[model samples]
Target: MSVKIAVLGAGSWGTVLADLLANNGHEVRLWGNSAETAAEINDHHTNKHYLPDFKVSPKVVATLDLKSTLAGVQAILFVIPTAAMRIVAKQVAPILAETGAKPIIISATKGLEQNTHKRISQIIGDEFPAELAEGLVIFSGPSHAEDVATHDITSLTVASQNIGDAEWVQAIFMNDYFRLYTNDDMVGVELGGALKNVIAIGAGILHGLGYGDNTKAALITRGLAEISRLGIEMGANPLTFMGLSGIGDLIVTSTSVHSRNWRCGNALGQGQKLDDVLANMGQVVEGVGTAKAAHELAQQHHVEMPISESIYRVLYENANVQDEINKLMQRRGRREMDFQR
Candidate 1:
C-alpha cells in the first residue's frame, strides 16, 4: 500500500522523514525553499547542507516549486518551523482548493505560535478549510533526525482528533526501524512536544555550566512537572505527559547532542551571545522562541512554571544564566504537591 506523499520543508528532519518514506516504498516529493538544496537532493540524492555525508534515497525527489510537488500528492506532511507554518499553510490552502485534492495533513513541527500561542495543528486548521484540516495528525516523540537517518530504532506517536486518522498515520510511518503508536489526545501530544524544548534548553545550560547527571536529572524531572501543569491548564490530559511525546521527548531533547535547542543553550551557558550562538548553529533552535510563548501562556493561564520562565528570561531578557539558576534553587520549597491537582 504505497502512497504518494509530499513532505513540505526539506530541513534535516524533513529530508530524513522523506527518505524514510521512500525506503518504505512510497513515492515522496520533498519540497524545499532553496533551489540549490532541491537540485542537490534531486541530482545527487544528498542534502549536504542539512544531512551531510548521508546518502538520501533515490526515490525521494526534491523540488522548489510547491505547486509541482503537490500536483499528485496523496498525503501532505508539514515539517517546517512553527513561525512559517501559517504563511506556508496560507499558500497551500488555495492550491489545495484549486486542485480539488484532500490529503490527510500531518504536522511534525513542534512549537506554539509566538503571539497567538496556538499549536501547529490549530494554526494549520485556521488556514485550511475544515474538510482538509479537521483530520490533522501530529507526529512527534523523542526521535531525532540524526539517529533516525542512521536506521536507529525510533518510536513516535501519531495523535489526531480522529482515531482512524491516527491509525492511518501509524500504518504509514511504522516499520522495522521506525515505529509509531496512535493516540487520540492531540492537545496533549502537541503540548508535550512543544513544551519539552524549553526544559531541554535548561538541561543544555546545565551541561554548559559543567553540571553532572544529578543536576540534569533534577531539571528534567521538575521540567516535566512544569510542562504538565501548563498543559493541563490549557485543557490537555495529564496522563499524556507521562507518555512518549512528553517525558520521552523531554529526555531526548534535553540530553541528546543532536538537539539544536540543547546545543544553542549550551553555547549560551558558556557565555556566548544569543546572536552568535544562533548564527553559528545553522539550524532553527525552536526552544528559544517556544520559551517566550510558554512564558506568555503560563502567565495567561495563571500557571506557575518557574523553569520555563527562567529559560525565557535567559533567552530574551539578557538575564544571567547562573543568576537564574541560583534563583531557581533558592526559591522557597513547598510540601510535595500532587501533579494531578
Candidate 2:
C-alpha cells in the first residue's frame, strides 16, 4: 500500500527522508522554501543546495507550492531548521487544513525554540489544534542526515503525547536500514534531539584541545547528565534521558565528524568566530541555535548545566572560547563518576 508523504523543508534532512519514503514505494512530495531549489530538485532529482551527493528518487516531487505538495498528504515529516519551525508551522497549518485535509504532522526537527524555549511538539500543538490538526508525532535519534542518506543502519525513536501515537509512527517509518522504536516520552525524545547538538559542540572543543579518548568519553557521559537534569526540570520523564534518544544521540553527535554542530565547533575551536564558522559551513549546525535555547532554559529553570552554560556564553555572550574551556576544567572539584559527585 503506497502512502502519500509530504516532507517539509527540502534541506538535507528533509531531502533524505523524502528519498527514503519514495524509495520505499510511497509518493513523496518535497516542499522547498526557495523556488530555484525546488525547480532544481523537481528536474534534476537532487537537492543542489543541500543533499547533493545522494541521487534523489524520481518519485519525489520537489515543489515551491506548499498546498499542492500537501494534497492528500497522510503524514508530513518536518525537517525545517529549529529557528524556522514555528514560522513554517504557522504557514503550513492553514494551508494543510485547506488543501483537502491536513495529514498527521510528524516533526523530525530537533532543538528548543529560541527565546520562547518551546519544544517542537509544543510549537505544533500551538499552531494546529487537535480538532483541526492531525495527531502529531516526533521522529528522532542518533540518526544523521549524511549516514541516513547513505542507507546506514540507523535506529530512531518515534514518540508522541501517547504511546499509540508513537506506535502509529513506528509502523510507517520502520524499515530494514532504519529501525524505528516507539517511546511514550515526547519530552525525552525532543530533549534528546535538542540537547545533543550542544554536547557535540563541546565534544568538538575537546577535540580541538587535542584531548584523548578519556576526555571525549567524559564529555559525552556528563553531557547526558546535563540533558537529563534540564529535561526533568522541564517536565520530561527522567528515565527517558537514559534511553536511545538521550545517551544514544549524545554519543553519536559528539563523536561523528558528519555532525554539522560538531564541525562548526571544531572551526570555533581553531579560532573562528561564530559568524565566520557558520558562513563557512555548507549545512545547518543545529547546536548553535540549541545552545541559546538551553541557556535561556537554564536561567528559567535554574538547572546547573555548566558545560551547556559555557558553550552558550562562548557562542552568544562574546566570552573567549578557550577561556571558558579552562574555566570548565577548573570548576569546583568533585568525583568524576556520579551526578552531583
Candidate 3:
C-alpha cells in the first residue's frame, strides 16, 4: 500500500530520507524552511547546499508551505534539530487540529531539550494532542546521511509504545539497503540515540588529541556504561543499551568522519573555538547541546557520568579539553561492570 508522507526539515538527513521514501513508491511531501532548498529540490532534483553530489528523487515534491505539506498526509517524519522541534511541533499542532488529522508522528531527530532535558518524543507529546501523539515513533540508530545516500547497508530501530505502529514504520523504511527493527522501549531507544552524540564528541576529542585506537576503544566502552547508567535511572530498559540504538550508535558516531558531533569535537580538540567550529560545520552539532542536557540529567539523577560531565564543561564552560581529560584520568577507579553507584 502506498502512503502519503510529509517529511519536515530540509537538511542532509531529511533530503536523503525523503528521497528514500519516494524511491519506495510513497507520495512524499518534503517541507523545509528555506525557499532555496525547496526550489532546488522541486526544479533540479538536487540539494547542493546539504547533500552536494547527490540528486534528490524527482518523485518527492519539496515545498516551503507547511500547511500544504501536511494536507492529507498519513505520516509526518521530523528530521529537524532539537531546538526547532518544539516550535515546529507547535506550528503543526494547530494545522492538524484544524484539519482533524491524526497522522502517525515520527521523530528522527535525536537530542534532548537543553534546559528541560526532555526527549524528542516528549517534546512532540507536549505540543500534539493525545490521539496524535499516543503512537509516536522514534527512528534512530547508527545510520548516517552520507552512508544512506550511497545505499550503504544500514539497520535502525523504530520504537513506539504501540508495537503495531513501530512495525508499520519498519515496513515503510525497510529496503534491501535500509533495514529497520521494531522495539517497544521508546525511552531506551530515544536516550540511546541522543546520549551517544555526547560520547562521540569525547571520542572525537581523543582522536584530535592524537590518542590511538586503544584510548578510543576504552572511551567508547566506558561511555556506554555511563549512558546506560543515566538511561536506566530515567526508566529505560537495561538491555536496550546493548542494541542498535545504544552501543551501535555510539561506535559509529564516535568513529565516523560524517558525524557532525565528532567533527565538532575534533575541531574543539584541535584548539578551535566552539563558535568557529559550529560556524564552519554548516550543520547542527547535536552533541554540543546534548552534552549540557546529559550533564544536567546526570546531576539531577545523581548518576556518575564523569565523561559526559567533562565534555559538557569543555564545550560550555571554556574548560581546556586536555585539562578535562586529565581530570577524567585522575578520577577514582572502580569496578568495570559496576553500573550502580
Candidate 4:
C-alpha cells in the first residue's frame, strides 16, 4: 500500500525520512524553505545544507511551494526547527482547513516554544481549531539523522493523545531500515526530546573541560534525575523517563559527538562565545532556548533542577560556568536522596 506523504523541511532528518519512505515505495514530497535547497533536492536529489554526500531516492520530489507540498498528501511531517514552527504552522493551518484534507500532522522538531512555553503540539493546537488539530502526532526519541542516514539501528517513539492516530504514524514509519514504537505519554516523550539537549550541552562542557568518565557518568545520571523530577511534577509519567525517549536519549546524546547541542557545548567549554559557535554551526541548538525555559519551569514548580539552573545562568545571566559547577558539586545538603525527587 503506497501512502502519499510530504515532509516539510529538507534538513538532515527530513531528507533521511524522505529517503526511507521513497525507498519503501511511497510517494514522498520534500518541501524546503530555501529555493536553492528545494532545487538541490528536486534537481540533484541532495541536501547540501545537512546531508551532502547521500543522494535521495527518485521517488522523493522536492518543492518550494507550500501548497504543492501539501497536495494530495495523506500526512504532513513537519521537520522544521522549533523556532520556525509557528511560521510554518500558520502557513499550513489554512491550507489544511480549507482543503478539507485534515491530514495527520506530525511534528519532528524537538524543543519548547520559549516565549509561550508550549510544546510543538500545543503550538499547533493553539494555532488551529480542534477540528483542524485532529490527528496530531509527535515523532521523537534517541534517533539522530546522521546515523539514520547510514542505516543504523535507529528506533523511535510516536506519541499522541489519540492512540489510533499514533498507530497510523507507526505504520507509516516502520520499515526494514528503521523500527518504531507507539507511546501515549505525550508529555514525557516531548519533554524528554526537548530537555535532553540541555543536558547534552552540559555533558559536552564537562568533556571539553577534561573531565573523566566518572564525571560524565555522574552528569548523565544526575541530569536524568533532574529531568524526571520536573517531568513528574508536570503530569508526565515518571516511568517514561526510564524508557527509550528518556535515559536512552540522554545517554546517547551526552556520550556521542553527533549531537548539535553537545557540539555547541564543546565549543563553549573550549571558551568559545555562544554567538561564534552558533554562527559556525548555522543550525539551531535547541538547548540554548530549552535551558532557559526548563530553568524557568523549575522555578515556577518549585522543582530543583540544579543542572538546568546552572546552564540557564551560564547562558543567560553570564554566570561563570566553573562557579556553577562548584555550586552543584559542593552544595551543602543532606544525603539518602530519592532519585524520584
Indicate which candidate wins on lDDT: 3
Worst 10 residues of 2 by lDDT: 332-341
Clashing pairs in 4: none
Which candidate would rank higher by lDDT, 2 or 4? 4
Candidate 1: pairs in clash: none
RMSD of each: 1.1, 1.9, 0.8, 1.3
Candidate 2 displacement at residue 296 in angstroms: 1.8
Per-residue lDDT of model 3, residues 157-222, tens digit only: 999999899999999988999999999998999999999999999888888889999999999999
Candidate 3 at 124: error in angstroms? 1.2
**lDDT (C-alpha, whole model) for all candidates:** 0.91, 0.83, 0.93, 0.87
Error of 4 at 154 (Å): 0.8
Superposed Cα deviation of residue 195, candidate 3 (Å): 0.8
Candidate 2's displacement at residue 11, Å, is 1.0
lDDT by residue (139-251, candidate 4, tens digit) is 98888888888889988888888889899888877887688788889889989989999999999998888888999999998899899988999999988898888998898
Worst 10 residues of 3 by lDDT: 332-341
Higher-scoring candidate on lDDT, 3 or 4: 3
Residue 197 C-alpha lDDT in model 3: 96
Instruction: Decide which is better by lDDT, 1 or 4.
Output: 1
> Per-prediction TM-score, please?
0.98, 0.94, 0.99, 0.97
Error of 3 at 58 (Å): 0.5
Task: Write the candidate numbers in order of decreasing TM-score.
Answer: 3, 1, 4, 2
How many backbone collisions does model 3 have?
Answer: 0
